[model samples]
Target: MVNFTHQDQGTSASCWQQAGLEQIAALDPEKLFHAMASVIVLAAHPDDETLGAGGLIRMALGQGTDVHVIVCSFGEASHPDSTTHSAAQLAALRHAELAEAMDMLRAQGPRSGTLHLHCLGLDDGKLAAQQEPIRAALEQHAGERCLIASTYRGDGHPDHEILGLLAADCALAHNACHLEFPIWFWHWAQPDRQPSFRHWFRLALDASSTDAKARALEAHRSQTTPLSALPGDEVLLSEGFLQHFSRGAEIFRATWPGHRDAASAPAVFDELYGEREDPWEYRSSRYERRKQQILLACLPQERYAAVLELGCSIGVQSAELARRSTRLLAVDASATALAQARRAVAGMDHVELLQATVPRQFPQLEPGSLQLVVLSEMGYFLAADELEQVLAASAAALQAGGELVVCHWLHPIEGWPLDGEEVHRMAGQLGWERIVEHREADFLLEILRKPAGAHG
Candidate 1:
């Protein structure tokens, strides 16, 4: 399962700003508030509303929309290990801060309801168990065509995910339009390489709205201020994380109603890669370049006869692998990426690029037919069963003593069912003798070899 501490200083907002985050799309004010008499904003914790949708709340209220703020928890567990304060103390403080924040936001606009704050008082870290309570709390606000904004269902936090999904469910049940506001996504997600870009949008916060959000966020001083000089009492939301919310606009995602179960992964990626030559900066990023160098150094042999590279994104590393193998078959799901890979390996007859998804479209692996298989920076995209299938196929394809390298980012991604550590853990269960194991703060790499005399 994915795990992380809030203390992790994450990706700087400058990277996102540089990636053209502001240029994606603008939410039309008319369409945003059209026919919606009420707006319900659900947050997993105390300050989530201020961080993710404070500007949205202000904007909705300013347009004569009655706003209801539902906070799932007081975020008491934020500093569970604090020596200076107990969980109960933190809960009271945070609850009060939330009330103050709500009051501050309410003061920003003339047209808003008095029944604004709805604190469920659920356990902070244990929200997954209280789904019924969360749903019931939202169900109380059931009405006609209310605009509901919840935390992103895949926002990488366990509590956030549960609240997001339940809020979406409630919206659907009431036939209300819903949106997802990402609180933790900005901290861990790579710039511009996330869920379908089409669903993303931003609301431009005027000076007044931006100032209101800042002041409302400031009201949550227990989160922003350190409890004491003691250890474990440090601020949870650091400057780097807060930077994500410091912008003049807040980002939100909207999904087409009634299509909850359908996701076009290939189409999402096609849009990602088609928009740019290098979406993740694989060719230019020093972090990525260093990672490739490390993976190259982990190769167990000087060369291999036949090799397969799965999820060979833009062929930056595919071209490198081409030189080490007599024949290289690189497979990717995105045709746009495959086209870029084609250019990266131009005129290299030894290299081949194919557009193929994993498991379903995964090429059959003839037992003991290949010398090497490289599964890099992928696998986490697959469901647990699908990843296991890919691993089993790679194991069957590799000849005795053949090497298989699996590498992936270590940070928590929005929708990954598994993390980098879990990927290596599952691969370790394959019983292959690990030849090389490398772990970095941001990524994980493992090179395992099929044992000699073991039937594939």
Candidate 2:
């Protein structure tokens, strides 16, 4: 998708300065040190905490707030092609570096508060499959009134996005304050083309905190400099990339308690539909018509006993699906969208329309009740874990030999963490047999069948 690497010449800090980053509202130090009982920092890799939230952690620790840094992976793959060191050796070296950096911060705090470091030893670049372990680590150290901070969701990196989503969910479950800091967002994102820039809080580092962060970043020698004069051990964080974090301020996206439910998908789509009748032009677009026909042609059978469509926006395709099913249940989150859908399929007693927020609140279905589950053009709306939950729910409802069809637009959806190809790839890993695979520049169509003898 976005072709960027640590070696690329990244956007300079001067460019960001010109973009008015200095104008973000300053984080209230009194409220942070007074209201929050503790701080829990999550890092997909070792240097993330140092890069994104080092100054904030130091300030919190100086105020006697308990601080915990949870590193999800050893980041062994960062230098995979190294000729000098093996992965195990690299892991050990990074572990020691992280500890040394923590000790440096612990001494700088001057409050004698607790500063702990945790390394989960998860594999690098594959955190999408390690959601359970990530959740367990967060639950083990999180406090009731703590602030849970992690990488920015939709940070253009899969590992960072996964950690962000998990941390947000953990914060929601435990009723903790959540903040998202950006590391890659700086290197990859142009200041103008960034994700929603609302609700950002700035922490202007004091002289002591700034010096402490500078020293801690240097402790990570393997990344700041190079491990050796070898081929693969070259410097990972280029000077230009590091400049983005070395600025004397930190920015965080704040999602407090009232904001934790994520503004509700229903409200989001309602705002879009209220502005216009068909935001996506599902009824008249030739592309939409062609995609629906292709999806209909990919079905394994001529007709189905029962069918379900996860996001039947405005019900144009729901009308087509109803024609091919004995019973059809079309679901959407927006009531406005569903009302239009209701009119599209009027007088069809077999077709039912229901409004629901999925993954967080999935509709109940009897076990082995569905003959077909059609998730056409909707899976990308969910984050990684949300998509997994939907897949699990579909698996529970589909009987043996029942089919699940996924068709999604191929391009990236703005403000979302996943794309169409990623959804299909993750769904294909559920151990079900994929009987049909079709790909086009605009979309992808996949059909997976539940295996024989597997219980619903």
Q: Could you say which candidate leads in TM-score?
A: 2
For model 2, the superposed segments whose C-alpha errors exceed 4 Å read: 107-110, 261-456
Q: lDDT tens string, model 2, 241-317?
A: 88888789888877665342332467668878999889988888999888888888888798898898998989999
- Name the best candidate (by lDDT): 2
TM-score for candidate 1: 0.59
Residue 283 alpha-carbon offset, candidate 1, angstroms: 48
Model 2, residue 45: distance off in Å is 0.8
Candidate 1 Cα outliers beyond 4 Å, as residue runs: 108-115, 192-198, 256-456
Residues 159-194 of candidate 1: C-alpha lDDT, one tens digit per residue = 887877687677656767677888887877665344
Specify the poorest-scoring 10-residue window by lDDT in model 2. 256-265
